[model samples]
Target chain A: MKRVVILDPLWPLEESADVIATLDVTLDKAAEAVGDDVVAVLAAPEQRVPADLLDRAPNVRLVGTCSTGYDNLPVPELQAQGVTCIHVAGYCDDEVAEHTITLASALLRGVHQLDRFTREGGWWPFPREPRRIRGSRLGIVGFGRIGRLVAAQGNVLGMDVVAYDEYVDEATMRDLGVEKVDIDTLFETSDVVTLHAPLLPETRNLVNARRLAQMRDDAYLVNCARGPLVDHAALGDALIHGAIAGAAIDVYPVEPPPADEPAFGWPNLMVQPHSAWYSPAASLAPYTRQIDDLARFLRGETPVGVIPGGS
Target chain B: MRVICTDDTWPIDRAQATLDRVGATVEFAYEVPAGEDIVGLLTYPGCAIDASILERVPNLKVVATCSGGIDHLDVAGLAERGVACCNIRNFCDQEVADHTMALIYACLRGVVMLDGLVRSGSWWPYPQPPRVVRGARLGVVGFGAIGHLLVQNALGAGMEVLVVSQHAGADEIAAAGATKATLDEALSTSDVVSLITSVTDATRGMISTRELALMRSDAYLVNTARAALIDHEALGQALEAGEIAGCALDALPIEPAPPEEPARAWTNTILQPHAAFYSEASEARSFDNPAEDVARALAGEQPLGLLQPVS
Candidate 1:
């Protein structure tokens, strides 16, 4: 029987046990159980499956991450060792997309500020003037699955959707009914700009001071993708000086932003932990897909959802 | 002609500009003096224009309101004094619709609560699964302009739209791709129920304890219309008892909700300061329309939004 190692406690082990059974495998959550008998490792995005950890499981040929992002896994190193690394992508597209819209809508409509007012027992009819989402321009920084879904929803809300993605062709954008624009124009023209790009070396600090300065004074910024894409100091400063109207951030440069983080207390800023991709339906999709991939690997068919080397 | 504007919150410059175009002089004063030559009286939604106030402005020919609803003004009293009362009805339809969707999204996705968790240094993923807007049933309580726009957007986002309205015909609701539902059916079957109906003798306190009891335990309620349409005390009790999940309210029975408001203690509630119809675009329209109506009233032409007192 094949021995499978599960490193993440949050993994839906019981739900996917039947699939593992079909592969004639015995699953163990103990990392120490990873030995010669282990052929696969099931992990989460936050779990670090480094080279040393992989070295212990020499017989392991497949590493399946039950998440769309594989930044925690060293893909190039795994490829060099002839190990297949797969991640579930496109599982939480709708969830993340809806989250992005929610952030933008909340910021524009002043939901967070108003909520605070109500909680403080402040008088009703506080002088908060909010901008409407309809007839406003929505700028999507990435044109991937999640970005496309946000754009489609923005169109449904009667917003003029514009996007910036170097890799997406103009024809495809037109087909999706989204206007293609350069990054600077998108930042300048959009009333609400959202980031959906992956965190990469080249993409780090993409929303720097210069780009932020180009945004409309009344515009809002929302980040639900990865936090490193935005400069924390610049965002804080911009919000402080009222360079922009407001912001709603779901991801942070550092998880559990330090207690002293100034942005946490900003009246104009709405902060959320990295919980955008979390919905009952979305949380289940990835684990189920990863289990199916593992079953396919055991069948000697090339495992699907393999991350290309250097990506 | 001289016009007396009683609301200081109304845009003075915009109203003045429109009045100038039509060759009318305007004076803005929060207090209306007795025996003034005020040919036109400008009032806001929450401001009272009773018989006493009318008697003060004995020469008042028209009462133009910078709001959609004329509930604050005694329409019968105005008609008895031979005064034309006009309101800006459709100017903020899109704004209210946008705000309604924002509240719905905030409540369903637990955006406000999740933000609080992150701010308090709770970075772990929230254990409770968030509700998704995509396939859920959305019950809209009214089918006015705002309700129609909300229905279109909700349907576009893949939600099943259900509407209950006394004024809208079955064909009109069906043409909008929504099914007609009675108030009980809407409350019982919907995952999210939004109140968009105007407050009236028949509709006031429509969602009290009995009506709330019919809703699902996990469902949410959003109100961007009148606060009198819901019983706040009952809503607070329902939330405390877990009879319903949560609510997002833009209107309260009392503006500047007193510090002792019961709903203020409920964490499941999101309250805004009656700001649903506020947006830069809508604010501009609110001022411009009332000024034009004043101009038309002076010119002996019919005002666009003239209101006739019920016989």
Candidate 2:
């Protein structure tokens, strides 16, 4: 039987274990899968497969991951070892995109406050504040699958959808009917801003104090892409100082944020622990897709989802 | 009796204070993680409450739902076991109605995506997407409290409104500034269809494949009610095939949808995790209003919002 190693402990162990004769392991348990030249390795966002596992599994021709972010994988090592990496990227594109929109709308409409008062039930003796979305400006940071999807939904909300993706040409953006815009103009004009770009060296701390200072006084900011994409300290300070109206965040630089984190202390900030991609429907796609790719790879067929060689 | 609050504060505190005024012991657990049991359960929508949970607390006399919908609890099971079920349904009509319009505007304008792009430094070079909300047909599928609120908001936005509900008359709907139409007519002519109806046998699956087919290709739908009101597969198909422009679903057939459903990956859809009614005012209402019902129930007087006995 062909051995398949799964590096993520939290992957759908029940369904995937049945898909193939497999060696299921956490990142630490990965050594067991390497014996006798395992055919493939399946991974997820949190798992980091070491070089030893790659070297030991000599027959491992494919490294399949259940995540769009393959940064956790040792890509250079895999390339050097002649191993191809395939990822179930963009599987949660819509979920994340949808979440980004939800957070943006919430911030614009003062949802955290609304949630607070609604929980009290007329006890606060204060009239509720009201806001509408018809006149706001929405700026999208990345125009990938999720960004494009958010753009389509945003059009239905009646706000302008301005987007800036460095890799997307003006013509491509126009084709999607999204207006290509400059970063500064977007912040100054937008009533709300949401992030969907990949977290890369260039994008780290992308939403620093200088960029946030350009946003409208009542504008909202959201980051569902990656926590490092925004300077958390700057964002928390912005919320406290009212530099921006509010923020909704799902991803954090640190998971299970330490109890004393500034994000928890920010008055207008709403935080959801890195759970945007965890809807019941979105969670299974990555694992199932990884399994399918492994099945194909084991059959000596090139898996369809392999990331382009250069990427 | 002492009560422990969950992650929410405003409503629970108000209710706790009210109970305190009446000389009942109250203990608020400001942030109870999901699945942990407090001696008394002060519930909120999207918070986990189930039948098996009753086994853990022998002194539990009531399950107070802080929102209009009590489907989160096993009502029949609770009633049969002599546990009282109380829900606050009418307190946040205007607030929720306002949110429905907010979603309409958010979806139409691409507000969420644009906001993210600008603040992330990507908008410095891109143009904003075109957006319009005025003059569009706003269809209200359920002309209840929240629906009525949405009708007024839509009219204020300078849009023609359409109201479709089981109990609405032409004269009453016209008075609300919306033309009365059959569900099919509402689906077809609407630029935006908002659902605010209760989920029932007649209303369940109200918007299925046939109804969605009647919608204009560029039209959108918004639901702030139970997810069972619409057929999920039909909505997914409508979005994927571009049969309907898009949808904003605050509630889903299943909460925290299991990962793997293709719907999670669907583009052009907005999911809100069922929080439209959760303003601070609404939460306070949900908490205190339920107490009123409880007080009445305990007094041997018929409680407001008592579950209707099935025929």
Candidate 3:
């Protein structure tokens, strides 16, 4: 019998057994797709499916990642070899947006800082003032699905919501009660600036030293999108010099940031591990959805989440 | 007539302007000056005001506190002595609601824990996996201005909210875009339960050992109200035993949590100084409203924040 390899040890194999049975494939947790009997290989966002996978698992017909980003997958190379490459999209949009809003609120309210202050026996006059969420300006760097959701949430909290996205028109933003602003204006005026843009070569370091300097000294920054979107070093310097009130970042230039993660010592900064896209309800969603897609591909049906270029 | 502002941090200038029109001179003082000329006294949440205060200033006509929570002020005792008591309200409602939502997000997304994990040289697989906020059920334990505003905030963010209130009816809770639930049900089912209710006789230590035992092991508790609303020992035990996933506390049993604060050692808890109800604008309102109320009371006008004795 053919086998499917899931590189994520935490993958809900027992819960996914029904789907595996339907496809008539035995799913096994593996460190690598080295067996010729492996017809399908799947990976979590942090795991990598090397481009040379086909060299070992020659019969592999499907390669899927249980995440929105496929940076770890060689889509073009896999598709050229007649392999169907897929990635789960739109599964964690709400989670990412919620996390972004949470980080923004934490910064504004000084929840993290106040907590530390209290534990340290310093209280009474709050060293850092907690800001009001209502009427505070929330500027979104990307007006994509997740960004739009964040704008809606901020608007509901009575915040002045604005977004900067060249692809998203002003009228569209207005429909969601969001004001469309230029990127420079977003950085200059927003009380809280959050990044929801994808990580691309052109988009990398979008928040450079100049952009950080553009922000109000009392303003805050939140990044739950991608790590490389902002210049990590610049953010550290800005924090050191108190260029901005504070920042909350979930992603980093390096995952599981090295033992000497400089962010730990940075004052007025909140560091979050890259665990935003999770919840018991949505925890198995990506895996189940991907497996269902795999089953569809097995039945000669088009999978819903095939990579654009690969498809 | 003279008005004394007991809190040194209070900007007496804002209140002095209002009193100036009424021919009342207000000044900051360390203690209540013993004199028939003192007509009014302005205090903050930390100062305990009751009938005993009348002994210090026998001719005291009114007392005002620059905070909504009147737990520190004995309204009934002061009212019995023919003294009008006013506590600031609606001034920081939005700030409290926003901060509550922030803590809710922090707990559900495990941002605080995740941040600690990253700093401790760990990363994904998330030591504390974040939960999806949109569909997560939030149990709000009050129906006051802040709780109602929080319901709007949560619903706007697409969270399923369950409100447990003795004051609000099922229809009223439902009208606010939240489901009405019994305390047990809310505790047993919700992903996060927030306490925004005041600490009345029936509410003080409301969340005790039995109550903590009702919560789902994976659930969290957030308190932005008063520390007395929960049993500190019970909460610590619950956290130590993992009876609940975690908790975020804005109010501690002791303000400026002493060097030996037990909660600091509790597992998966986020501690916040009593700084939830704050913002530059809200802070000004907190001081301005109380000052104006005291001025009104001195001017032979009914105070807007008059706390009528609960019959």
- The lDDT leader among the candidates is 3
Q: Residue A283 CA error for candidate 1 (Å)?
A: 2.0
Docking class of 3: medium
| CAPRI docking class of candidate 1 | medium
For candidate 1, the iRMS in Å is: 1.7
Higher-scoring candidate on DockQ, 1 or 3 = 3
* Candidate 2 global CA lDDT score: 0.69
The residue-by-residue lDDT of candidate 3 on B1-311, one tens digit each, is 99999898898888888889889999988788788888898997767777987777888989999888889888888888889999888888888888999999889888887777778777656789888787789999999999999999889878899999998999999888999999999999998999999889989999999999999999999999999999999999999999999999988887657888899888899988888888888888888888888878888889999999884
Question: What share of the reference contacts survives in each candidate?
Answer: 0.84, 0.04, 0.92
* DockQ, each predicted model: 0.70, 0.04, 0.73
lDDT of 1 by residue, B1-311 (tens): 67888877677777788778667778878787765667888888767786667667778888899888777878888788888889888999988988889888888888988877777777776843567889999999999888999998799878899999998888999999999999999999999999988877899899999999999999999998888888888898899999998898887777667777677778678878777888877777888888889988888899997888875
What ranges in model 2 sit over 4 Å off? A16-36, A51-59, A120-129, B1-98, B101-311
TM-score per model (chain B): 0.93, 0.77, 0.96
- Candidate 1 chain B — worst ten consecutive residues by lDDT sum? B122-131
Q: Write the per-residue lDDT of candidate 2 for residues B75-151, one digit (tens) a residue.
A: 77777766667777687776577677767865654444443343343321222232345567888888887787778
Given candidate 2, what's the lDDT at residue B192?
86
Alpha-carbon DockQ of candidate 1? 0.70
Best-to-worst TM-score order? 1, 3, 2
